[model samples]
Target: MKKIEYGMDFVARNLGIFKCPVCGRSFEKIVHKSVSCDQGHLFDFSKKGTLYFLKHGVKSDYNDETMWQARRNVLQAGLFQPIVDEISSFLSENRSLRIIDAGCGEGSTLKYFENKRESNKDIYVGFDISKRAINLATQGEGSAFFCIADLAQLPFAANSFDAIIDMFSPSAYGEFERILKKGGILFKVIPNENYLIELRHMLYEKNDNHYSYSNAEVLSLFKQHYPQARVKRINYEFTLKETSFEDLLYMTPLHWGAAETKIDDALATGLAKITVDVLLLMVEND
Candidate 1:
C-alpha cells in the first residue's frame, strides 16, 4: 500500500460534467443536457457514472483474474521500475492532475505512481476492459478510481483528462484526443525489439520476433491527428529472479506458446537479466 493524496479529494469534489466527447469542449456542468456537440453528435452518461462516446467496440483477452494476479506479482517485484520511474518523472511537477491509465492492468503501475508521488495528490483513474482487474484495483487502499470500460469508446467526456497513459496496450487515438484537455499530454509506452529476450529464448528455444517501430513512424501517425507532439525514449535492463520466472511467463501475451513444462524448467534454471526498451511520447491535442 501507498499513502493516498489529499489533492485527489479536491478533484473528486469538484468533479462535474466534463469534456464534450464530440467537439472536445469543456463544460462546467452536465444535467438534463443531452450531451451534443456542434456537429449534432450526441452522447449520454450511464447510470453507473460513465459516459459512452465510442461508436464501435473493442475486445480484450486480459479478462482472467489469474493472469492479472501473476502480472501484478511480477510488476511489484521491481522488474519494471525503470518504466515506472519514467512515468513518475513526467508527472512529478503537476498538482491535482487528473490522470487516467487507459489500459491499466492489475493497477500496479497506477498504484506505483500514486505511492511514489503521494504529495502531488493527483486523481488517478484506472480503466480496463476486464472487470476482474478493476475489482482487484479498487480493493487496494489508494486514491485511484477504477472503471471497467473499453478504450475504443471511453466513458469520459472530451477534454476531461489532464493526462492519459496507454502502456503497451491498444490505443484509440481518436478517443485519446477526445478525452485529453487542451495542451494535456498523452503518454504511450510501446515495447522495443528486445523487451524480453531471456523469456522468449527459454520458452521458444529461439529468438522471438519483436514488434519493431521507428520513433518517426509513430510520430508521423500522431502528427497526422495532432501536429504538435514530442517523443521521448527510455531504455533499461532488469534482472529476473527464479521465483518470478513463472509469473513473467503467465503475465505476458507470450504465455499462449509457453508450455508448463518449459516454465518449470526455467524456474529451476535460476535468475536471468533482460532488457526493456520503451518509447514514451508526449502528444498535445491539436
Candidate 2:
C-alpha cells in the first residue's frame, strides 16, 4: 500500500488524539487526503506516509540525512539496548498505552521500545521538528506513526498521552505537563559526564574547560519541574566496530565545533570502547 494510505489508516485509528496547532481545535476526521479541524486548518500526509503538522517551516541542525543514518547505525548496533530494556520492562506493566516520543529523532528508539514489549495495545506516535528526521523515521519497519512538529508547540490535546519519552532532547516541560494524562509518566534521558568521554577527550585534549562536562544544572532543572521524580543512573560501556565508531563520531554533536584536524585524529585513532553513562528521570503527572 502507498504510504499516504497507510498513514491515513493510522490517523483514522488515532484521530481523537490530535488537535490543530493553529486553532487548538480537535480534528474530527480525515477529509480525503488531509485531516481537518473545525477551523478548517488542513494537514496533509506527505507522499512518504508521514504527516506535516508544523504551522511554519523551521530550520534545524539535525536536518541532514547522514547524521540520522549514522544514528540509526549506532542504535541498531545495540549501544542503547540497556536503556531500552529498562523502559520496556517498566512499560510492560500497563495493559495499554498511548505514547508520544517528544523530539523523537529518526524514530529508532521509539521503534525499539515498541518491539521490546509484549503488548500490541500501545499506540506509538513520534514527532520531530526536523522534516528529514521524520522522513527517515517513516521508512523504518514499524506500526508507529511519525510526524513533523515542534516540541514546544505540540500539536495535541490536553491530557492525551499516557507517557512522553524525551531521549537526549530538550525538554518542553510545560507543554509536556499540558498534554500528559493525570498520573502519566514522563521518561527523560540525559547524558552523564562519561557519555562519549573518549570523543570529548580527543576533540578537546588541550582545552581543559571543554574536556570536563557536568549535568548538575540539567538534573537540577528536572528536579525543579518534578520535585518528587525518581532518577536512575545507568553506567556501562559498549565495544564498537571501526565503522560503528565512525558512525558514532558523525552521529553525535560532540565534534560539531571541533577542528577538522582533531576529528581526523580521533577517526584515525579509532574508538573501540565507549561509555554510555546516563540518567533516567521518571516523573508522574499529578
Candidate 3:
C-alpha cells in the first residue's frame, strides 16, 4: 500500500475541489508531491504543506517578507479582535461546512476564527496570490489549509466551498459564484467611509470626498450575484498603542502616497486611537 502524505489525506478526503490552475480542469489524482489533471498540468505541494496555484504574472503589495511579518505582528497585537468578534457572530451554526478565506494575507484572520471555533471540527482554508503570505500562513495548523492562488481565477472546482470569507480583500464574484455550493454564504468586509479619518487628516489634505467610501458599486455587484444580501456597518474606536503606531502606518495602503515628513509628523504628534469602521455584507448563493 502507498503511504499517504501528511496533508494529502485531508485533501483526498474533503477537498476534491483542488483544480488545475493552468487548464481549469479538476485533478484526477495526487502522485509524488504533485496534483495532476488529465493534461499533465502539475500543481506541486511544497514540503512546507502549501500548494502554489498562481503560475504567471503574480504581483502583490503584500508579497514582501517584511510586509507579511509586519501584518502578522499587527494582527498578533489584537488590533482586529473586535472586528473578528463581530464577523464571527454572523457565521452560520453549521459546523461541517468547508470555509475558505479569499486573499487571506498572512492567514491571521482565518487562524483567529479557527481557534475560536476549534471544537467545531470544520475545515478551514486560506488562499492568497502572494506566495510570501501563504508561506508565512503555514505556521499554524488547527484544521487550517493554506494555498497560493488568485481569487479572481481560483484553483478549485465548481460548487466546492460552503462559505467564502472576504475581509478587506478583492472579490471575484464570477469565480465565487462558480465555486460556492448552493445556499453557501459569502461574508464580505469593506472599509467604512470614516475608517481612518484621523490618519488621513494627519498625513494629507482633508477631503471629505476622499474619506467618504461609497459602496454603491460593491452593493450593486452583491445584488447582481445574491439578490437577497444584507449589509451592516460594524464601527468602533480603540486607542492606538504607541508601539503599534508605526506598524499601523506601514501596514496600511492609505499612506502609500504620503510624504515621509508628514508620516513622521503624524507619529510625533502622539495622537491616540482612531475610529474602526467597516461594513459586513452577507450574501448567499441560492
Candidate 4:
C-alpha cells in the first residue's frame, strides 16, 4: 500500500461540525451534542464517519462506478497538471483550511492537492452527484467526505467552507454563496477556446467553430452574480504523449462525437502538443 500524506490525515482529524447542514457555517469545533443551527435543522453524523446534509432531490446517472474510474485514470496521468498547479498556487496562502470541491468527479484534483501540500491541518471534502465517485474517493489515502448530492442544492449550510473549487462543472451561485465562509475563496475553472483541439480536429475531420465563451463574458457573468469577487486567468500549453492524447479524447465531452476511424487515425498519428486555457476566478464570499 502507498503511504497516505499528511493532508489526508488532516481531513480525518476535523471530521465533525466543520460543516453545518442547514446554514453551511464552518465551525472550528463542535460545541453542541447534536449538530444544529439556530434555525433548528439537525444533521447526524453517519456510521461511516461522514455527514449527509442534503435533503432535497438529486440526480442518479452520475452514481455509476465505471465512469468515475475512467475519470480518475485520465486525471492521474498528469495530463491536466497545469490546472492542478494553478489551484494549488491560488490556495497557497491558506493553511489549515476547510476546502470543498464541488462536482469533484473522481477526486483526483482534491487528492493531488492533499498530496502536494505540507499541512495536515486542512480538511478536504469532495461532493458530487455520483455516489460511485465518492466511494472511490473514500477508498483512497486522502481523507475526503463524499456525498451524492445536487450541485444546485448542496447539502451543506451557508458560509461553511474556507474555499470551494468548481472545475469544469455546473455552478450554483446561491449555494456557493451560502456554503463559502466570509472572505472565502471560490476557484472556478473553465476551458479556453483551444482546449482539446486535437480531438476536435479528429472527430470532425476539420475544425468546426469551437464553442467558447470569452473571458469578458465570464467576467460579466461573475460580476453579475458575485460583484465583490476578484478573478484571475491562467493559460498555458502542454505536450501530450500517445497515452495522454488518448486519455484527453476519452475523458472530454467531445468523446461522444468521435468516430472509430478518427480515433484510430489519432492513435496512429502519435504525439501532439495542446494548449490549455483555464480561467481561475478567486471570488470572495460577500
Top candidate (lDDT): 2
TM-score of each: 0.75, 0.96, 0.89, 0.75
List the pairs of residues colliding in candidate 3.
Answer: 240-273
lDDT of 2: 0.87
lDDT of 4 by residue, 100-217 (tens): 9998887888888788774745777887776567667766666666555667767665566888988988788888887788878888887666666555666664444433334567
Q: Order candidates by TM-score, high to low.
A: 2, 3, 4, 1
Error of 3 at 236 (Å): 0.5
lDDT of 2 at 95: 71
Q: What overall lDDT goes with each candidate model?
A: 0.67, 0.87, 0.77, 0.66
**Lowest lDDT block of 10, candidate 2:** 87-96
| Candidate 4 wrongly placed segments (more than 4 Å) | 1-67, 92-94, 205-219, 241-243
2 against 4, candidate with superior lDDT: 2
lDDT at residue 175 of model 1 (Cα atoms): 80
Q: For every model in order, what is the number of clashing pairs? A: 1, 0, 1, 7
Query: Could you give candidate 1's per-residue lDDT for residues 1-286 as a string of tens digits?
Result: 1222232232235445244444555444333424444455555443333333444564557777778888888888887778778776766474778888988878888888888888888877787877667666655667676655666656577677888888887789988887788877888887665667666666665443422224456556766866666666677777776346667767887766567887678778845676777677677555
**Selected candidate, larger TM-score, 1 vs 3:** 3
Ranking by lDDT: 2, 3, 1, 4
